[model samples]
Target: MSADARERGRIVVGVDGSESSKDALRWAVRQAELTDSTVDAVTAWEYPPLYGSIGWIDAPQELAGDIKGAASRALNHAVKEAVPPDQTARVHCGLAYGTPAAVLLDQARGADLLVVGSHGHGGFAGALLGSVGQHCTQHAPCPVVVVRG
Candidate 1:
């Protein structure tokens, strides 16, 4: 890490290509600006479970790659939409293959703050807090901020 990076704080936010996630990204960016911190926007994906007549089956490698690619695209899109062009330099985007909560927690390991949407693409639509958000708030290594969209 560069000396400048070490001196500036880091904020990790989870993005799931959902409206709420976008709101969370926006909130994180504003917070980063105020605190002079850099935002790490992260998205995670996993191969969908396939069911066969015999039992569970592995997803094809090509299909898995496609899913991963989609996740990357979503992360990029979310960052582009949420961050202002002038503030782009303050944001870093990343994608990982894992559960959303786990990936976010990992990214926030040494961060000053962990941010997430109250409700993401998954979970009950009427829920005030999505499963991933709840998990992150409860388990993140750093202080967590749950933004409601």
Candidate 2:
């Protein structure tokens, strides 16, 4: 990587297969184009332990795999749609099992910018800023950009 590439040109974006997240991805891609930066679109997922609590019959391993796979697919699809064909090589996808904010923060280490949607499919869907965006703005190692949808 060139010295500038090694510097503040790596942008990490949080995506959740939601429209808001899609907007954030677009913003990140546009910014990357302007600065010759790269984009890392990340999505996070976790198997809820309460599924069995409600007497639902499902194998733990199978459920975990299904959830993980869906998350990965969502990340891939979002990246594919948001990034232009010419800039596809500059964008990457990351899927992990954890809270959204935590995963995005972990990925933001040494990154030039952390981007997230203003709201997501969370408890406070109508709020100005969802938990992930709020947490990232407060705790990210680098500057955070919350793209409002």
Candidate 3:
């Protein structure tokens, strides 16, 4: 891990290429500006196993690579849309290969705050706090801020 990986006082935000996540990203960036903390926007992705794989026809690595690329692009787009041009330098993006809650918790290891949208693009879209947000709020190592859509 690099020095940046171990940096403290960072504000970690979970984004999933959703409108609510964009709102959370903007809120996190604003909070970071006020607290003089760096914004670390993170997106997580996983390629589930194929339901019925034919013999020697599965390309898990390629599929996983594509998913990772999409996750990276999504994270970059979210940060670009949420962060102002002047403050972009202070914001960093990360793509994790795991569940959103796990990724956010990992990012929150040495962070000051963990921010997430009230309801992301999860199956329970009508809930106040989606599974990822609820999980992070209850399990994050740091304080969690849930931004409503």
Candidate 4:
């Protein structure tokens, strides 16, 4: 960490292994490099327990393992694909629980810029911003970047 690294804030991206998210990740990497920031490429995955937050239980034991494994794999693979070998040194990866919008909003607490893809599984073409992107932009503690794809 340098002077700016101490002074600068995090540049976080919400990714789910989608093409649009890959675009956001790429943009976030460049922003981090130019701004002397670090990339916090984040992926928020929901597990069965989260869906059962209302006190329901008894999900298969494999369910937890499977969701954690999938989330980690997606986070790692996105970092590998979006960040170049040289820029890799500045990259960080994280996986969390809850909805994409909620997760990214919480991550915004420490970030200077929160980046997200314009579309996900539920977004339509030419929508400019997806639901998560829209939520972060309006609710993030810092600046939000919607990397349109």
Global lDDT of each candidate:
0.92, 0.87, 0.84, 0.84
**Preferred candidate (lDDT higher): 1 or 3:** 1
Against the true structure, what is each candidate's TM-score?
A: 0.96, 0.88, 0.87, 0.85
Which lDDT tens digits does candidate 1 get at residues 32-61?
999999999999999988999989987887
lDDT tens readout by residue for model 2, 1-149: 66765764889999998989999999999999899889999999986755556685544767888899989898888887777899898888888778898899999998999999998877574577887888899999999999997
- Compared to the true structure, candidate 3 yields what TM-score? 0.87
Worst 10 residues of 3 by lDDT: 50-59
* Candidate 1 structure, TM-score to reference: 0.96
Model 2 CA deviation exceeding 4 Å by range: 1-8, 51-59
Give the higher-TM-score candidate: 1 or 4.
Answer: 1
* Clash pairs for candidate 2: none
Candidate 3: tens digits of C-alpha lDDT, residues 1-149: 66755553589889898999999999988887887778888899987655554543434686887888888898888888888999898788888888888888998997899999988776674566788888888999998999986
As for lDDT, the candidate ahead, 2 or 4, is: 2
Q: Pull out the clashing pairs in model 3.
A: none
Compare the candidates by lDDT and give the number of the best one: 1
Candidate 1 wrong stretches, greater than 4 Å: none
